[model samples]
Target: MMVKVDRLSYNFGPHWVLKDISFSLDKGEFLFLTGHSGAGKTTLLRLLYGALPVNRGRAQVAGYELNKLKKRQIPQLRRKVGVVFQDFKILPRRTVFDNVAMALEVRGMPRPHLERRVRAIVRAMGLETKSYSICERLSGGEQQRVAIARSMVANPELILADEPTGNLDFDLTMHLMDIFKQFHTYGTSVIMATHSREVLDCVPEARILHLQDGRIVTDSEPGLEEDVQ
Candidate 1:
Protein backbone atom coordinates (compact mmCIF):
# COMPACT_ATOMS: atom_id res chain seq x y z
CA MET A 1 0.00 0.00 0.00
CA MET A 2 1.18 3.50 -0.71
CA VAL A 3 -0.73 5.01 2.24
CA LYS A 4 -2.15 3.53 5.43
CA VAL A 5 -4.10 5.17 8.24
CA ASP A 6 -5.00 3.30 11.37
CA ARG A 7 -7.46 4.88 13.78
CA LEU A 8 -6.32 8.42 12.99
CA SER A 9 -7.78 11.29 14.96
CA TYR A 10 -7.15 15.04 15.03
CA ASN A 11 -8.51 18.02 16.94
CA PHE A 12 -8.41 21.80 16.73
CA GLY A 13 -8.57 23.12 20.28
CA PRO A 14 -11.70 21.32 21.55
CA HIS A 15 -13.28 20.61 18.19
CA TRP A 16 -12.39 17.23 16.67
CA VAL A 17 -11.85 17.44 12.91
CA LEU A 18 -11.05 13.82 12.30
CA LYS A 19 -12.44 10.86 14.24
CA ASP A 20 -10.69 7.53 14.13
CA ILE A 21 -10.28 7.57 10.37
CA SER A 22 -8.69 4.41 9.04
CA PHE A 23 -8.05 3.45 5.45
CA SER A 24 -5.47 2.15 3.00
CA LEU A 25 -4.60 3.00 -0.60
CA ASP A 26 -2.89 0.57 -2.90
CA LYS A 27 -0.08 1.30 -5.34
CA GLY A 28 -1.29 2.91 -8.58
CA GLU A 29 -4.84 3.26 -7.28
CA PHE A 30 -6.73 6.51 -7.98
CA LEU A 31 -9.15 7.50 -5.22
CA PHE A 32 -11.51 10.44 -4.66
CA LEU A 33 -12.49 12.02 -1.35
CA THR A 34 -15.95 13.60 -1.52
CA GLY A 35 -17.66 15.58 1.19
CA HIS A 36 -19.49 18.82 1.95
CA SER A 37 -17.79 22.02 3.07
CA GLY A 38 -16.23 22.02 6.56
CA ALA A 39 -15.82 18.27 6.24
CA GLY A 40 -12.52 16.75 7.31
CA LYS A 41 -11.36 16.05 3.77
CA THR A 42 -8.75 18.81 3.69
CA THR A 43 -7.51 17.91 7.16
CA LEU A 44 -7.09 14.27 6.14
CA LEU A 45 -5.14 15.29 3.03
CA ARG A 46 -2.91 17.52 5.17
CA LEU A 47 -2.19 14.61 7.49
CA LEU A 48 -1.31 12.33 4.57
CA TYR A 49 1.13 14.89 3.16
CA GLY A 50 2.77 15.60 6.54
CA ALA A 51 1.58 19.23 6.42
CA LEU A 52 -0.20 18.73 9.74
CA PRO A 53 1.35 16.75 12.56
CA VAL A 54 -0.40 13.51 13.34
CA ASN A 55 -1.90 14.00 16.78
CA ARG A 56 -3.03 10.37 17.23
CA GLY A 57 -3.15 6.96 15.57
CA ARG A 58 -0.79 5.40 13.09
CA ALA A 59 -0.08 6.62 9.56
CA GLN A 60 2.48 5.68 6.97
CA VAL A 61 3.33 6.78 3.45
CA ALA A 62 5.72 5.11 1.03
CA GLY A 63 7.13 3.20 4.04
CA TYR A 64 7.87 6.27 6.25
CA GLU A 65 5.96 5.97 9.51
CA LEU A 66 4.22 9.27 10.21
CA ASN A 67 4.73 9.31 13.96
CA LYS A 68 8.45 8.66 13.55
CA LEU A 69 8.91 11.46 10.98
CA LYS A 70 11.37 13.69 12.76
CA LYS A 71 11.29 17.44 12.26
CA ARG A 72 14.45 17.20 10.18
CA GLN A 73 13.09 14.39 7.98
CA ILE A 74 9.80 16.10 7.09
CA PRO A 75 11.30 17.90 4.09
CA GLN A 76 12.81 14.71 2.72
CA LEU A 77 9.53 12.84 3.19
CA ARG A 78 7.61 15.62 1.42
CA ARG A 79 9.85 15.32 -1.63
CA LYS A 80 8.37 11.88 -2.23
CA VAL A 81 4.78 13.03 -1.84
CA GLY A 82 3.34 15.60 -4.26
CA VAL A 83 0.61 17.99 -3.14
CA VAL A 84 -1.62 20.41 -5.14
CA PHE A 85 -3.72 22.84 -3.16
CA GLN A 86 -6.98 24.58 -4.05
CA ASP A 87 -5.34 28.00 -4.11
CA PHE A 88 -2.48 27.92 -6.58
CA LYS A 89 0.68 28.70 -4.66
CA ILE A 90 3.15 30.08 -7.15
CA LEU A 91 5.97 32.57 -6.78
CA PRO A 92 4.55 35.78 -8.17
CA ARG A 93 7.88 37.11 -9.40
CA ARG A 94 9.19 33.81 -10.69
CA THR A 95 8.72 32.42 -14.16
CA VAL A 96 6.85 29.15 -14.61
CA PHE A 97 10.03 27.15 -15.16
CA ASP A 98 11.70 28.60 -12.09
CA ASN A 99 8.71 27.80 -9.92
CA VAL A 100 8.84 24.16 -10.97
CA ALA A 101 12.60 23.99 -10.94
CA MET A 102 12.64 25.33 -7.41
CA ALA A 103 11.41 21.97 -6.21
CA LEU A 104 14.45 20.21 -7.64
CA GLU A 105 16.80 23.03 -6.77
CA VAL A 106 15.90 22.83 -3.05
CA ARG A 107 16.79 19.13 -3.05
CA GLY A 108 20.31 19.78 -4.46
CA MET A 109 19.59 18.53 -7.94
CA PRO A 110 22.26 19.62 -10.43
CA ARG A 111 21.26 22.67 -12.48
CA PRO A 112 21.56 20.72 -15.77
CA HIS A 113 19.40 17.89 -14.49
CA LEU A 114 16.85 20.30 -13.07
CA GLU A 115 16.43 22.04 -16.42
CA ARG A 116 15.95 18.76 -18.29
CA ARG A 117 13.41 17.42 -15.80
CA VAL A 118 11.51 20.66 -15.27
CA ARG A 119 11.23 21.36 -18.99
CA ALA A 120 10.10 17.79 -19.65
CA ILE A 121 7.31 18.09 -17.08
CA VAL A 122 6.32 21.55 -18.26
CA ARG A 123 5.89 20.25 -21.77
CA ALA A 124 4.03 17.23 -20.50
CA MET A 125 1.60 19.61 -18.78
CA GLY A 126 1.03 21.46 -22.11
CA LEU A 127 2.70 24.60 -20.88
CA GLU A 128 5.78 24.47 -23.05
CA THR A 129 5.48 28.04 -24.28
CA LYS A 130 4.48 29.42 -20.93
CA SER A 131 7.64 28.18 -19.25
CA TYR A 132 9.05 31.69 -19.52
CA SER A 133 5.81 33.45 -18.62
CA ILE A 134 5.34 35.05 -15.23
CA CYS A 135 2.97 33.14 -12.96
CA GLU A 136 0.85 36.21 -12.14
CA ARG A 137 0.23 36.82 -15.85
CA LEU A 138 -1.12 33.35 -16.55
CA SER A 139 -4.80 32.44 -16.67
CA GLY A 140 -6.49 30.53 -13.87
CA GLY A 141 -6.20 27.17 -15.63
CA GLU A 142 -2.67 27.89 -16.71
CA GLN A 143 -1.66 28.85 -13.20
CA GLN A 144 -3.23 25.69 -11.90
CA ARG A 145 -1.21 23.72 -14.42
CA VAL A 146 1.93 25.36 -13.12
CA ALA A 147 0.97 24.29 -9.61
CA ILE A 148 0.34 20.74 -10.77
CA ALA A 149 3.59 20.72 -12.67
CA ARG A 150 5.44 21.81 -9.58
CA SER A 151 3.85 19.02 -7.57
CA MET A 152 4.52 16.26 -10.11
CA VAL A 153 7.97 17.37 -11.32
CA ALA A 154 9.63 15.26 -8.67
CA ASN A 155 7.73 12.19 -9.90
CA PRO A 156 6.67 11.50 -6.33
CA GLU A 157 5.28 8.14 -5.37
CA LEU A 158 2.03 9.64 -4.13
CA ILE A 159 0.02 12.71 -5.22
CA LEU A 160 -2.48 14.36 -2.88
CA ALA A 161 -4.56 17.21 -4.30
CA ASP A 162 -7.26 19.30 -2.63
CA GLU A 163 -9.81 20.70 -5.07
CA PRO A 164 -7.30 20.90 -7.88
CA THR A 165 -10.02 21.70 -10.36
CA GLY A 166 -11.74 24.38 -8.34
CA ASN A 167 -10.49 27.17 -10.60
CA LEU A 168 -10.83 25.37 -13.91
CA ASP A 169 -13.64 25.35 -16.41
CA PHE A 170 -15.43 22.14 -17.44
CA ASP A 171 -13.14 21.49 -20.38
CA LEU A 172 -10.01 22.26 -18.43
CA THR A 173 -11.26 20.19 -15.52
CA MET A 174 -11.57 17.13 -17.74
CA HIS A 175 -8.15 17.85 -19.18
CA LEU A 176 -6.59 17.84 -15.73
CA MET A 177 -8.42 14.67 -14.76
CA ASP A 178 -7.08 12.97 -17.85
CA ILE A 179 -3.58 13.99 -16.86
CA PHE A 180 -4.08 12.52 -13.39
CA LYS A 181 -5.43 9.31 -14.89
CA GLN A 182 -2.34 9.09 -17.04
CA PHE A 183 -0.21 9.46 -13.94
CA HIS A 184 -2.12 6.64 -12.24
CA THR A 185 -1.54 4.51 -15.33
CA TYR A 186 2.18 4.94 -14.77
CA GLY A 187 1.91 3.59 -11.18
CA THR A 188 1.73 6.79 -9.11
CA SER A 189 -0.91 6.56 -6.40
CA VAL A 190 -3.34 9.52 -6.51
CA ILE A 191 -5.77 10.83 -3.87
CA MET A 192 -7.84 13.89 -4.80
CA ALA A 193 -10.32 15.63 -2.51
CA THR A 194 -13.09 17.60 -4.12
CA HIS A 195 -16.84 18.26 -4.07
CA SER A 196 -17.23 18.40 -7.85
CA ARG A 197 -19.37 15.58 -9.16
CA GLU A 198 -18.71 16.54 -12.78
CA VAL A 199 -15.01 15.94 -12.38
CA LEU A 200 -15.74 12.65 -10.60
CA ASP A 201 -17.96 11.63 -13.49
CA CYS A 202 -15.04 12.15 -15.84
CA VAL A 203 -13.37 9.16 -14.21
CA PRO A 204 -16.16 7.08 -12.76
CA GLU A 205 -13.74 4.21 -12.35
CA ALA A 206 -12.08 5.89 -9.39
CA ARG A 207 -13.05 4.75 -5.89
CA ILE A 208 -14.98 7.51 -4.11
CA LEU A 209 -14.98 7.72 -0.34
CA HIS A 210 -17.56 9.99 1.28
CA LEU A 211 -16.87 11.72 4.58
CA GLN A 212 -19.25 13.46 6.98
CA ASP A 213 -19.19 14.57 10.60
CA GLY A 214 -15.47 13.84 10.77
CA ARG A 215 -15.97 10.19 9.82
CA ILE A 216 -15.76 8.07 6.70
CA VAL A 217 -19.44 7.37 6.27
CA THR A 218 -19.25 5.29 3.07
CA ASP A 219 -16.33 3.11 2.14
CA SER A 220 -15.34 2.01 -1.34
CA GLU A 221 -18.03 -0.12 -2.93
CA PRO A 222 -17.36 -3.81 -3.61
CA GLY A 223 -18.35 -3.63 -7.28
CA LEU A 224 -16.20 -0.57 -7.98
CA GLU A 225 -13.50 -2.70 -9.52
CA GLU A 226 -15.33 -2.70 -12.83
CA ASP A 227 -15.90 1.03 -12.83
CA VAL A 228 -12.42 1.96 -11.65
CA GLN A 229 -9.74 1.40 -14.19
Candidate 2:
Protein backbone atom coordinates (compact mmCIF):
# COMPACT_ATOMS: atom_id res chain seq x y z
CA MET A 1 0.00 0.00 0.00
CA MET A 2 1.15 3.51 -0.76
CA VAL A 3 -1.04 4.99 1.99
CA LYS A 4 -3.04 3.63 4.90
CA VAL A 5 -5.06 5.49 7.51
CA ASP A 6 -7.13 4.31 10.45
CA ARG A 7 -9.35 6.17 12.90
CA LEU A 8 -7.79 9.49 11.96
CA SER A 9 -8.94 12.69 13.65
CA TYR A 10 -7.61 16.22 14.03
CA ASN A 11 -8.39 19.61 15.62
CA PHE A 12 -7.26 23.15 16.31
CA GLY A 13 -7.10 23.58 20.06
CA PRO A 14 -10.59 22.67 21.30
CA HIS A 15 -12.48 22.77 18.03
CA TRP A 16 -12.48 19.61 15.93
CA VAL A 17 -11.63 19.75 12.28
CA LEU A 18 -11.51 16.08 11.28
CA LYS A 19 -13.41 13.28 12.97
CA ASP A 20 -12.41 9.64 12.86
CA ILE A 21 -11.47 8.66 9.31
CA SER A 22 -10.01 5.57 7.68
CA PHE A 23 -8.73 4.91 4.18
CA SER A 24 -6.13 2.94 2.28
CA LEU A 25 -4.58 3.74 -1.06
CA ASP A 26 -2.70 1.33 -3.28
CA LYS A 27 0.31 1.96 -5.43
CA GLY A 28 -0.52 3.68 -8.72
CA GLU A 29 -4.08 4.45 -7.63
CA PHE A 30 -5.60 7.87 -8.28
CA LEU A 31 -8.03 9.04 -5.61
CA PHE A 32 -10.09 12.21 -5.53
CA LEU A 33 -11.04 13.88 -2.29
CA THR A 34 -14.34 15.75 -2.71
CA GLY A 35 -15.63 18.06 -0.03
CA HIS A 36 -16.74 21.58 0.80
CA SER A 37 -14.14 24.19 1.83
CA GLY A 38 -14.34 23.45 5.55
CA ALA A 39 -14.82 19.73 5.17
CA GLY A 40 -11.20 19.05 6.23
CA LYS A 41 -9.92 18.14 2.79
CA THR A 42 -6.81 20.27 3.06
CA THR A 43 -6.34 19.20 6.66
CA LEU A 44 -6.31 15.56 5.66
CA LEU A 45 -3.83 16.27 2.89
CA ARG A 46 -1.63 18.11 5.37
CA LEU A 47 -1.53 15.12 7.66
CA LEU A 48 -0.66 12.82 4.80
CA TYR A 49 2.22 15.05 3.73
CA GLY A 50 3.53 15.31 7.30
CA ALA A 51 2.88 19.06 7.43
CA LEU A 52 0.51 18.57 10.36
CA PRO A 53 1.06 16.28 13.34
CA VAL A 54 -0.89 13.04 13.37
CA ASN A 55 -1.83 12.75 17.03
CA ARG A 56 -5.11 10.91 17.13
CA GLY A 57 -4.81 8.16 14.56
CA ARG A 58 -2.54 5.97 12.51
CA ALA A 59 -1.34 6.95 9.07
CA GLN A 60 1.29 5.21 7.03
CA VAL A 61 2.48 7.10 3.98
CA ALA A 62 5.26 6.09 1.62
CA GLY A 63 6.43 3.56 4.17
CA TYR A 64 6.68 6.05 7.05
CA GLU A 65 4.45 5.98 10.08
CA LEU A 66 3.01 9.52 10.34
CA ASN A 67 1.96 9.58 13.99
CA LYS A 68 5.35 8.33 15.07
CA LEU A 69 7.25 10.46 12.56
CA LYS A 70 9.97 12.76 13.85
CA LYS A 71 10.94 16.25 12.77
CA ARG A 72 14.18 15.14 11.14
CA GLN A 73 12.38 12.27 9.46
CA ILE A 74 9.88 14.64 7.79
CA PRO A 75 12.29 15.43 5.00
CA GLN A 76 12.79 11.73 4.33
CA LEU A 77 9.06 11.21 4.00
CA ARG A 78 8.72 14.24 1.73
CA ARG A 79 11.31 12.84 -0.65
CA LYS A 80 8.79 10.23 -1.80
CA VAL A 81 5.71 12.49 -1.76
CA GLY A 82 5.22 15.63 -3.78
CA VAL A 83 2.64 18.24 -2.76
CA VAL A 84 0.75 21.00 -4.55
CA PHE A 85 -0.91 23.32 -2.10
CA GLN A 86 -4.18 25.23 -2.69
CA ASP A 87 -2.10 28.34 -2.19
CA PHE A 88 0.86 28.78 -4.51
CA LYS A 89 3.80 28.52 -2.13
CA ILE A 90 6.54 29.42 -4.58
CA LEU A 91 9.03 32.12 -3.71
CA PRO A 92 7.58 35.43 -4.96
CA ARG A 93 10.93 36.86 -6.00
CA ARG A 94 12.31 33.71 -7.54
CA THR A 95 12.24 32.79 -11.19
CA VAL A 96 10.18 29.83 -12.37
CA PHE A 97 13.36 27.88 -13.08
CA ASP A 98 14.62 28.50 -9.57
CA ASN A 99 11.30 27.53 -8.08
CA VAL A 100 11.17 24.25 -9.92
CA ALA A 101 14.84 23.45 -9.43
CA MET A 102 14.55 23.91 -5.69
CA ALA A 103 12.97 20.51 -5.33
CA LEU A 104 15.97 18.78 -6.84
CA GLU A 105 18.44 21.11 -5.18
CA VAL A 106 17.37 19.98 -1.73
CA ARG A 107 17.91 16.39 -2.73
CA GLY A 108 21.57 17.14 -3.49
CA MET A 109 20.97 16.64 -7.17
CA PRO A 110 23.83 17.91 -9.33
CA ARG A 111 23.26 21.28 -11.01
CA PRO A 112 23.59 19.95 -14.56
CA HIS A 113 21.02 17.21 -13.95
CA LEU A 114 18.81 19.50 -11.90
CA GLU A 115 18.68 22.11 -14.64
CA ARG A 116 17.71 19.53 -17.21
CA ARG A 117 15.00 18.11 -14.97
CA VAL A 118 13.65 21.56 -14.06
CA ARG A 119 13.59 22.70 -17.66
CA ALA A 120 11.78 19.53 -18.71
CA ILE A 121 9.10 19.93 -16.07
CA VAL A 122 8.72 23.65 -16.77
CA ARG A 123 8.26 22.83 -20.41
CA ALA A 124 5.75 20.18 -19.48
CA MET A 125 3.84 22.84 -17.52
CA GLY A 126 3.97 25.24 -20.51
CA LEU A 127 6.20 27.61 -18.58
CA GLU A 128 9.39 27.18 -20.62
CA THR A 129 9.18 30.72 -22.00
CA LYS A 130 8.68 32.12 -18.53
CA SER A 131 11.40 30.09 -16.89
CA TYR A 132 13.44 33.15 -16.06
CA SER A 133 10.47 35.35 -15.19
CA ILE A 134 9.81 36.07 -11.54
CA CYS A 135 6.85 34.26 -10.06
CA GLU A 136 5.09 37.25 -8.48
CA ARG A 137 4.66 38.91 -11.86
CA LEU A 138 2.90 35.90 -13.35
CA SER A 139 -0.87 35.37 -13.51
CA GLY A 140 -2.59 33.26 -10.86
CA GLY A 141 -2.89 30.31 -13.19
CA GLU A 142 0.72 30.66 -14.23
CA GLN A 143 1.83 30.68 -10.63
CA GLN A 144 -0.26 27.61 -10.03
CA ARG A 145 1.47 25.93 -12.94
CA VAL A 146 4.83 26.85 -11.48
CA ALA A 147 3.79 25.25 -8.21
CA ILE A 148 2.80 22.14 -10.09
CA ALA A 149 6.02 22.00 -12.05
CA ARG A 150 7.99 22.32 -8.85
CA SER A 151 6.01 19.49 -7.29
CA MET A 152 6.37 17.19 -10.27
CA VAL A 153 9.98 17.83 -11.20
CA ALA A 154 11.31 15.26 -8.81
CA ASN A 155 8.98 12.49 -9.98
CA PRO A 156 8.01 11.40 -6.51
CA GLU A 157 6.21 8.15 -5.85
CA LEU A 158 3.07 9.90 -4.60
CA ILE A 159 1.49 13.29 -5.29
CA LEU A 160 -0.90 15.12 -2.99
CA ALA A 161 -2.64 18.09 -4.52
CA ASP A 162 -5.19 20.31 -2.79
CA GLU A 163 -7.67 21.90 -5.18
CA PRO A 164 -4.97 22.23 -7.83
CA THR A 165 -7.37 23.59 -10.42
CA GLY A 166 -9.33 25.93 -8.19
CA ASN A 167 -7.93 29.14 -9.71
CA LEU A 168 -7.90 27.98 -13.32
CA ASP A 169 -10.57 28.35 -15.98
CA PHE A 170 -12.22 25.39 -17.65
CA ASP A 171 -9.75 25.07 -20.51
CA LEU A 172 -6.66 25.67 -18.42
CA THR A 173 -7.97 23.45 -15.67
CA MET A 174 -8.46 20.64 -18.14
CA HIS A 175 -4.97 21.12 -19.50
CA LEU A 176 -3.34 20.90 -16.09
CA MET A 177 -5.50 17.94 -15.12
CA ASP A 178 -4.38 16.16 -18.25
CA ILE A 179 -0.83 16.56 -17.09
CA PHE A 180 -1.80 15.06 -13.74
CA LYS A 181 -3.48 12.18 -15.49
CA GLN A 182 -0.36 11.55 -17.52
CA PHE A 183 1.65 11.24 -14.35
CA HIS A 184 -0.90 8.86 -12.86
CA THR A 185 -0.54 6.69 -15.93
CA TYR A 186 3.17 6.46 -15.13
CA GLY A 187 2.30 4.71 -11.84
CA THR A 188 2.45 7.76 -9.59
CA SER A 189 -0.20 7.55 -6.91
CA VAL A 190 -2.31 10.70 -6.64
CA ILE A 191 -4.70 11.98 -4.00
CA MET A 192 -6.16 15.22 -5.24
CA ALA A 193 -8.72 17.32 -3.39
CA THR A 194 -11.11 19.02 -5.77
CA HIS A 195 -14.54 20.68 -5.80
CA SER A 196 -14.98 20.83 -9.56
CA ARG A 197 -17.03 18.07 -11.09
CA GLU A 198 -15.27 18.73 -14.35
CA VAL A 199 -11.95 17.94 -12.73
CA LEU A 200 -13.42 14.79 -11.24
CA ASP A 201 -14.64 13.70 -14.65
CA CYS A 202 -11.17 14.18 -16.05
CA VAL A 203 -10.22 10.85 -14.50
CA PRO A 204 -13.19 8.49 -14.69
CA GLU A 205 -11.34 5.58 -13.08
CA ALA A 206 -10.25 7.44 -9.96
CA ARG A 207 -11.96 6.70 -6.66
CA ILE A 208 -13.83 9.52 -4.88
CA LEU A 209 -13.89 10.27 -1.18
CA HIS A 210 -16.63 12.68 -0.25
CA LEU A 211 -16.39 14.51 3.04
CA GLN A 212 -18.94 16.49 5.06
CA ASP A 213 -18.35 18.33 8.33
CA GLY A 214 -14.91 16.75 8.58
CA ARG A 215 -16.29 13.26 8.27
CA ILE A 216 -16.39 10.86 5.35
CA VAL A 217 -19.95 10.61 4.02
CA THR A 218 -18.75 8.40 1.23
CA ASP A 219 -15.63 6.61 0.16
CA SER A 220 -16.51 5.38 -3.31
CA GLU A 221 -13.45 3.16 -3.45
CA PRO A 222 -12.67 -0.34 -2.37
CA GLY A 223 -10.19 -1.02 0.51
CA LEU A 224 -11.36 2.12 2.34
CA GLU A 225 -14.40 2.37 4.53
CA GLU A 226 -16.04 5.50 5.99
CA ASP A 227 -15.25 5.84 9.68
CA VAL A 228 -17.15 8.74 11.20
CA GLN A 229 -16.63 9.42 14.85
Best candidate (score: lDDT): 2
lDDT of 2 by residue, 33-89 (tens): 987778999999999999899999899999999989999999999999999996648
Candidate 2 residue pairs in clash (backbone atoms < 3 Å): none
For candidate 1, the per-residue lDDT at 72 reads 88
Clashes of 2: 0
What lDDT would candidate 1 get against the real structure? 0.86
**Candidate 1 structure quality by residue, lDDT tens digits, 1-229:** 8999999999999999999999899998888988788779999998887888986999999888998889988888888899998754889779999999988888899989899999998998789999999999999888889999999988889999999999888887888888898888889999999877677776666788788878887777424422321
Q: Model 1: residues >4 Å from true position, as ranges?
A: 222-229
Query: What does candidate 2 score on TM?
Result: 0.94
